[model samples]
Target: MKRREAREKAIQTLFQLENTELSVDEAITYITEEPTNSFYELLVRGTVQNQEAIDNTLTGSLENWSLDRLPKIERTVLRLAVFELLYNEDVPDRVVLNEAIELCKTFGDEKSGRFVNGVLSKLTKK
Candidate 1:
């Protein structure tokens, strides 16, 4: 699968893991039959492993909103993007930001894209 697809799957997996007690493997299996995409696995596992630090990084970038207060889709998108920004040096910051916005647009409400962009733009600037 493409990185975009992997990111989408990762977001879904992370979203599930956050709301339920599913393990990483269970989340992956639930999301896809061909779970062999290394990039996808890396995204889910890496994000889960580094979530506290990711959340900490996010805490500063949020303007008036706390991480816990954001909608689940937005929160998951931010966490996935933050994980890529901090851990995956292979992808550019712009790509991560754009992908995050796209994820929000796809999975969240009308305002989700701009909300994610606003938050991620601050992180990219810093």
Candidate 2:
């Protein structure tokens, strides 16, 4: 799958993992009918493995809003984006940010894009 598609799938898988008791493998299997690409697995696993650190980073970057208070989609999008920002050195920061905002627009509410942009902008600056 393309990177964008992988990202969307990663978000969905992560969403499922958060809301349910599914293991990473189970979540991945539940989300896709076919095999997943390396990038997709990297995202879902990396985000899960590094979640505490990612959430700490997010907690620091977030404004008045705490991490848990945000909607699930928004939180999931941020976690996926932040994981990429922290771990994927090959991808450009601008691309990660733009893609994340777009994902928010597609999967989250109207303001989700802007909210992601604001949080990620802070991360990029540091």
Candidate 3:
């Protein structure tokens, strides 16, 4: 899969994991098609394994918005993006941010992209 397709799949899988009783392993199995991409696997596993820290990192960056108050789609998108930002050193910061915003735009509500951008911009500065 293309990296963008993998990222989008990660977001969808992450969304499922967040909203359901599914464990990370189950979510990964549930989402992966045959010939799974390595990056997609890394994203879901890394994001789930580091969820608390990731959420806490974003909690401070969000302006006037608590983590729980954000819609699940937005929260999941942020989690996946922040995981990449923190863990994937090879990926450029601008690419991570732009891709996250694009995912938010495509999968989240109307304001999700801007909200994601604002939060990410602050977090990246730190």
Candidate 4:
């Protein structure tokens, strides 16, 4: 799978893990078993391990919107995209934003793509 596809799968897996009470190890096992590109295993693992810190950073960056108030799919996309933006220096911010927007378009509500883009744009400025 391409990097974009891998990122999308990672976002979906992360969303699944977030909605469930699964342990990180269990979540990782489940996610990796799915058909995905090899490039994303480490990325997914890192994102899961650092999720709390990522969420905290996102919460701080969001202006009027608390993380809880956002839809779950949107929050999950932001978490994955922000992790890439803040922690993965090798990935360009534009790529992160684009992939996040794509994920929103695929998995989120009609307005979520633009919403994700707006939030990520704000985050990059910070």
lDDT order, best first, reads 2, 1, 3, 4
TM-score list, all predictions: 0.96, 0.98, 0.94, 0.87
Error of 4 at 76 (Å): 0.4
> Model 3, 1-126: lDDT tens per residue?
889999988998999987799987787778875667899888888999999999989988988889999999889989988999999997998999899889988898669998888889889999
Q: Which 10 consecutive residues of model 1 have the lowest summed lDDT?
A: 27-36
lDDT of candidate 2 over 1-126, digit per residue (tens): 999999999999999999999899999999998988999999999999999999999999999999999999999999999999999897999999999999998998779999999999998999
Q: Which sections of candidate 1 miss by over 4 Å?
A: none
- Model 4 clashing-pair count: 0
> Which candidate number maximizes lDDT?
2
- List lDDT for all candidates, in order: 0.91, 0.95, 0.89, 0.83
Superposed on all Cα atoms, model 1 deviates from the true structure by an RMSD in Å of 0.9
Distance from true location, Cα of 16 in model 3, Å: 0.5
- What residue pairs are clashing in model 2? none
Winner by lDDT between candidate 3 and candidate 1: 1
The parts of candidate 4 lying over 4 Å away from their true place are: 32-38
- Candidate RMSDs in order: 0.9, 0.6, 1.1, 1.9
Better model by lDDT: candidate 2 vs candidate 3: 2
Residue 51 of model 4 has an lDDT of: 84
Please give the TM-score that candidate 1 achieves against the real structure. 0.96
- Identify the runs in model 2 with alpha carbons over 4 angstroms from their true place: none
Candidate 3 TM-score, true structure as reference: 0.94
